[model samples]
Target: MSETQKSKPEIEAPQSPAPEALEIVDLVEGDGAEATPGATVDVHYLGVDYDSGEEFDSSWGRGQSIQFPLQGLIQGWQDGIPGMKVGGRRQLTVPPQLAYGPAGSGHPLGGKTLIFVIDLLGVK
Candidate 1:
């Protein structure tokens, strides 16, 4: 496989202004289907607390990609994940409001800025 095919997701923190809103950066530009609103997407992901660098959740660890409609996810995901092509990878830095809000999403998240490395596996 080529480097683009085997490259691991890079861990990165967004430079200023990222904490204020949703920040998205593409890591791999895929050559397949594009994500649109209401499209069903199959993806692998890793979620972490930005400030603490602690992993909060991951689909990669579960060995399965999840399929979900774009409209059913969080605001940041809804706004950010779209335009990604199948087989693409993205790094998103989401502020609390776009994430779980003040109450957080339960243990390990705590309403802080979140960092996610998402692999767009497929789109239908």
Candidate 2:
């Protein structure tokens, strides 16, 4: 983490009727390099269930950011994160099919829509 890093962000609960497809919204656009589909990204992110409005994961909660290969993440992330630049903040609303899949698929978050707020730190 850098000294310029922002503190953890707060995600508001979403209203009913999650979108049927992936939704990407840029909260803060960055001036740094843009991310490519094959890039490895370092980011701080929070994920919550759209229906429950309960946090399910967070890199900020761990007091550190995480670096992951884009291909290794869920389909929603893979589709949503590219084109985002380092230092940007983005929100993604992901339906079950793009998140973990429908209920009984065994991933816990399966069958649920998910909301993620991501702060991009670096891309390589």
Candidate 3:
């Protein structure tokens, strides 16, 4: 298998009708503060494929979210969490531009939109 095929994250397409607008349910909205590029944040996330509604990954099962530096994440995450606040929840409909682009990173995600329900629990 090629490297591209290995890094892509597996995600099914969304089956539900696309909402006209995104609904954000913030459990803890960060203080409207900007997070540093390499800042570490702990959050609970539910990810579903935009076209399939199939769950791709979730931190909720673990009973808690995980923490990692924004810079250490994929482009989608690096760009997505900066605006969130502690205790904030947001539904992010990530386009291919903001997510895994044309040539997927080679895990299971092959150039697809990712819908994420993110709950910002805290920042370290």
Candidate 4:
């Protein structure tokens, strides 16, 4: 199905232990432009905590896509979003070190693995 035809995505709860490294999965591959490092991206996304399967954020919930420079996001996003094409959907499983940091790093999500489903809408 085309990216435009798909509705908001729902992430299934993971049954396995979180990995020690980053994991990337493309749910839908878009045919548009490829996103390069340092590019600004417009995307719709959902974020959930790996252990509790609880949602922490989602652009879909707000009924809009967010746009930002790729370099300005968290480590996981900075590492994961580049090389994706606009119109594609990708899932990222980010370990704590690549996410907020090891558990006591002070960020609310510190020490936690995060799961994110991202839809690339545009790249600039």
Candidate 5:
């Protein structure tokens, strides 16, 4: 067999399962209650590629959280953060539809399962 064919099984087998097939890991529960779509929130986050567990971005290294309008972010963020309260940490496994979609939207996130560890620091 060619090298490409031999390696294909090894690469595809492990990552074949869909993101939805994996369980979510919730680390902390927020105290201030859940967020809303238009709410501005301060959050510390780490984004990784679900299949690879590769670090994509992190706010914790900055020694501060970042703030953004929930509704303005990717569908994953908009849909995922509301149930989270201030001071809560949750993992989001976002399927491609809720993530960068097909074209990637400029970031390195396109047609992939995006994993996010989010800490909802505050609401403003």
Candidate 6:
């Protein structure tokens, strides 16, 4: 007896239009010190393409964290990250102007908006 195998269908991810302005949403406000400019911060972040909801980066999935000066990040991050305290979790919907700009990064992400959910672990 010869039988054919059945294949499951793949589901598409949700998409959103590019934001006109930066959107900041605080999921969990921490009780620690705020992340001021020039402060070194450790964070776990998930970055996705706003138009297609495609994941671009994630520190949590890597089972690791990143530490960098707050000012070193993009304008949206620099503006949004401040006031976020250690242990805080925030969602940032960044416009193209605040992200990689009209040129974007590369390929599919070009001239598109980006969304990032970041967790502030520590500040130094």
Candidates in order have lDDT scores of 0.79, 0.90, 0.64, 0.90, 0.69, 0.75
* TM-score per candidate: 0.84, 0.94, 0.69, 0.95, 0.76, 0.81
Global local distance difference test of model 4: 0.90
Instruction: Check candidate 6 and list the clashing pairs.
Output: none
Per-residue lDDT tens digits for candidate 4, residues 9-83, read 888889999999999999888889999888999999999999999999999889988999988888899999988
Q: What is the C-alpha local distance difference test score of candidate 1? A: 0.79
User: Over 4 Å off in model 1, which ranges?
Assistant: 1-18, 103-110
lDDT of 3 by residue, 1-124 (tens): 2232122233346556644333333434555445556789876777887877778788865665688888877676776677677656666777665666655568576566778877665676
Q: After superposition, how far is residue 68 of candidate 2 from its true place, in Å?
A: 0.9
RMSD of 3: 9.8
Which ranking of candidates, highest lDDT first? 2, 4, 1, 6, 5, 3
lDDT per residue for candidate 2 within 18-77, as digits (tens), equals 999999999888778899999999999999999888999999889988999999999999
Candidate 6's residue-wise lDDT over 9-110, tens digit each? 121343545569999988777778789877898887888877677788877667778899978888889988988987677889888888776773664555
RMSD of each: 2.6, 1.8, 9.8, 1.5, 11.4, 10.5
lDDT, candidate 1, at 39: 91
Residue 26 C-alpha lDDT in model 3: 40
| lDDT, residue 46, candidate 1 | 86
Winner of 1 and 2 under lDDT: 2
Worst 10 residues of 3 by lDDT: 1-10
* TM-score, cand. 3 vs. native: 0.69
